[model samples]
Target: MPRAVRPDRSINAEDYQHAPRPVAAMPKDYAPGEEIAPHSHRRAQLLYAVSGVMRITAEEMPAGQAAARPKGIWIVPPQRAVWIPSGCEHEVRMVGPVQMRTLYVEPDAAPGLPAQCRVIEVSGLLRELILALMDEPLDYAPDSRGAAVARLLLQELVAVEALPLHLPQPRDVRLQAVCRQIEARIGEELPLEDIARDAGMSSRTLARLFRRETGIGFQQWRQQARLAEALARLAAGQPVGIVATDLGYAGTAAFTAMFRRSLGTTPSRYFETRAPSPAARGRSR
Candidate 1:
């Protein structure tokens, strides 16, 4: 295929969404506490964080449904990316100074991609592929180096594993209200009975609704919510003691234990490691 004209790299995503290419990579930086307002994309997106963390909230609409419901919250740390399907309404909040490298893939260009939003692990090879593609022309020739990288990127994505860094939200208005309150008072130890009463439902009914709508029980959902918050705070360079205390953990040890149980690592160690270094990337290539 002949090369198409490339848009200005400094512009927003709207500039590249209509490009005549299977995949286009863009680099953007965000300051801590910056927020991208709610929006939708015509092409699917692989939002990768080279550093820092991103807290993304997306709305998922069932097939043939007119209205969309909150899917869940995903906490994306370094060396990880979130796959957002085409036309999915989503918003992002930066947990730290984020160096984001994103790829927008045409819907028909990549088959077998996930239909739902998910946080996926970005392997060393995939990371390098994304970085390399960022330096290529937007409309690279089909037989060019950029095209080769794009093909491998799509192949890697097909086999990428989804992470458990999601906190599912409920569809019911009453449950949504309860979830919002829980998120707001994440540091508080609110009793199930009191929360249910405030929502105008019995504890048993509230628990059932949580399980039915979110595929997780109330306590599990609460724990997941806490975990999501902790990841953001920790990624922002907060001390373990402070994050633990702010999130209602009794002590640093308890918080560390919880982090280990959920993510298989301590908070300090998780943020200590980052995307592969330049030397490592060279070796991989």
Candidate 2:
């Protein structure tokens, strides 16, 4: 299903381009089904969801990026942020009621960060820094204490591990067909050859193209897709057994194991631990 766009006016590059300082933070609150139309930014963005879930869909990513780089529609759970590199076209939608706190960083300021988008784990200290910096002016002086905080935020971003909540999107028509098929019947494990045949290609050819376009093997990609679906359903308070069964797992244990392996936590535990705190509630300036 196509994601619902936000009824509010869309935010775009001009909103932050030529920011006076290296980093600028803004706060935004979104209702469920709210969305931003396709847009890009000159500055890289750390799209942090403080109170709710969001789904981000990118236009085709730039070339030569690795698998570790996130692509496609990313599910932003609480306490997590999606790092969008400079100049990448993407759209955003809030899955539930969302408190969005975004930090826009100049591309040149963060040298060691990922060139492509990925979901980064937000540490407690980093989260505090983001909140504190929200009060800082975009043109805050570089040598000021506020600038020091921004510097610390940059240090925190370096090599931050990516969460596997992103679903890789393939651009090729054949691979798009295969991915759509998997998403439509996500409850069943379609054989590789069958998927390939439906895409009008041999199994080997499909396998190669899938990885080339999406940065992971077909199996792993499908698994990620399932996990992504599982996240939205699980967040809706669906029962574990139902979610597991709906995602094509034979039983709850099988599904639980996959969830744990993929995210280092079980379904029940992930939701329990990730509830938003009140401090995350902030308004757009």
Candidate 3:
């Protein structure tokens, strides 16, 4: 099967070009089906999906000039939101109709929050408090109760440990070609011969490298990539048939069966279980 294709808005280099100072909020309401672009800000951010589900991918940039980095993280859930520290580059993809409420805080405030990347649970009360904070206006008095509530909300954000579902795309010349081909033709079934040719190696050599670098065989690694894509596409509310076709699956049932095998639940139920808190629902407007 091929990888899945999602309907994210095209992103440009300039989006991740400029960096802002660590501080507070950005007044932007992401639409149900939109891409937040690949960008990094001065302040660390807590990307909470107030309503619906969202897919987030984050990684560290190379030491110098770069296209895209190696290691990657894929996040999809309402109860769970990714912690992006200041200066770390990241991208956002909305799955379904997501009401994303991002709390961008200064570096000084970082001490109170998670020091590393993690998924924080947005409990009911905490969710309400965050939505209320968003409505209090950016210029709310420093000594106001609203500010206190906001501080409390930040403190209440408990980090949830999870398996590191990140894949490290190596910097080897052979691996680069294979990675690019896979990304470019996400909707096409990748043939072993083509991948081996692109990598400038025999099929046997390529398979060995995949296992060594990625800890999985070429086929398994591709499936993981496809699953990551599927999670992103399905979270965006794409039809199963459309997603299946995009991933080069034989049919929707085949794609669904694969999804079920990888994940414990079906796509619809998986998304349904990720519904945002009531406060998230209130902030949907």
Clashes (N, CA, C under 3 Å) per candidate: 0, 1, 5
* Per-residue alpha-carbon lDDT of candidate 1 for residues 213-278, written as tens digits (9 for 90 to 100): 998899989999899888887777788899999999999999999999987888888777754544
Candidate 2 accuracy as lDDT: 0.79
lDDT of each: 0.83, 0.79, 0.62
Residue 160 error for model 3, in Å? 2.0
lDDT of 2 by residue, 1-285 (tens): 322222232244476677788888776787888889887887888998776787899744543354443448788877788988887878898887777888888888977977767887788888888877765666779788779999999999885888988787877867778888899999998899888777788999999988888878989988998988888787767899999988889999999999999999888877775533344544342
Across 121-233, the per-residue lDDT of candidate 3 in tens digits comes to 55666666665655554555667766776677666753334433344566577786787788678778878987897667898898888787666677776777787777667
Q: Clashing residue pairs in candidate 1, if any?
A: none
Shift of residue 83 alpha carbon in model 1, Å:
0.6
Off by over 4 Å in 2: 1-13, 59-71, 274-279, 283-285
Model 2: residue 100 alpha-carbon error in angstroms:
0.9
TM-score of 3: 0.63
Candidate 3 stretches greater than 4 Å from native? 1-27, 31-39, 50-57, 61-80, 91-99, 108-126, 137-148, 155-158, 163-167, 184-194, 211-217, 245-263, 273-285
